[model samples]
Target: MAQEGKLDLLLKTVEENKKRRVEAKERARVDFVGLKVVVEGRLPQVEKKVSDLGKVLGVLSTKVEQLESTVSRQARAELLPEDIREEHLDASPSLSTPLIRGSV
Candidate 1:
C-alpha cells in the first residue's frame, strides 16, 4: 500500500510538470507573436522615411551637379581670354616674345 501511494504521487507530479511546460510554451509563443506584430506595425513608417530620404538625396545630388557645371563654365569663361591671347602671341612669328633656343 505504501509503494502504490508513492507511485500515484509520482505520476501526479509528472502530469503537473507536463501541464506547466505546455502552458509556459504557449505563453512564450503568444509573446513572440505579439512582438512580431508590433514590429510589423511600425515597418510602414520606416519604409516611408527611407523613401523620403532617397528622394531628398536625389534632389541634392541634382543640385550639386548643376552647381558643379555652372562653376566649371564660369571658371573657363574667366580663364579663356588670357589663354587665347597667350596662344596668339606664341604662334605668331612677330617679335612680341623673345625665344631662347637653349630652354626646352
Candidate 2:
C-alpha cells in the first residue's frame, strides 16, 4: 500500500509539471504573435518616414550645390582685379543670376 501511494504522488507531480510546461509554451506563443503584429503594423509608417527623409536630403543637396557655386564665384571674383571682375560680369549676365529651382 505504501508503494502504491508513492507511485500516485509521483504521477501527480509529473502531471503538474507537464501542465506548467504547456502553460508556459502557450504564453510565449501569445507574446510572440502580438509582437509580430505590432511590428508589421508599423512597417508602412517607417517606410514613409524613410521616403520623406530621402526627399529632404535631395533638397539639402541642391541647396549645398547652390551655396558651393556661389562661394566659388565669389572666390574667383576676389582673386581677379576689380576691372576684370566688372568686365566678366558684364560679359556674362547669366552668371550674376541665382540658380533656377529644380535644376539639380
Please provide, for model 2 over 19-99, each residue's C-alpha lDDT reduced to its tens digit, 9 standing for 90 to 100.
999999999999999999999999999999999999999999999999999999997777758778788888875743344
User: The CA-based lDDT of model 2 is what?
Assistant: 0.91
Give Cα distance to truth, residue 53, candidate 2, Å. Answer: 0.6
Q: In model 2, which range of ten residues has the least summed lDDT? A: 95-104
Once superposed on the true structure, which residue ranges of model 2 sit more than 4 Å away at CA? 1-11, 81-104
After best superposition, candidate 2 residue 68: deviation in angstroms?
A: 1.5
Model 2 alpha-carbon miss at residue 97, Å: 47
Q: How many residue pairs clash in model 2?
A: 0
Can you give the TM-score per candidate against the true fold?
0.55, 0.62
Q: Could you tell me which residue pairs clash in candidate 2?
A: none
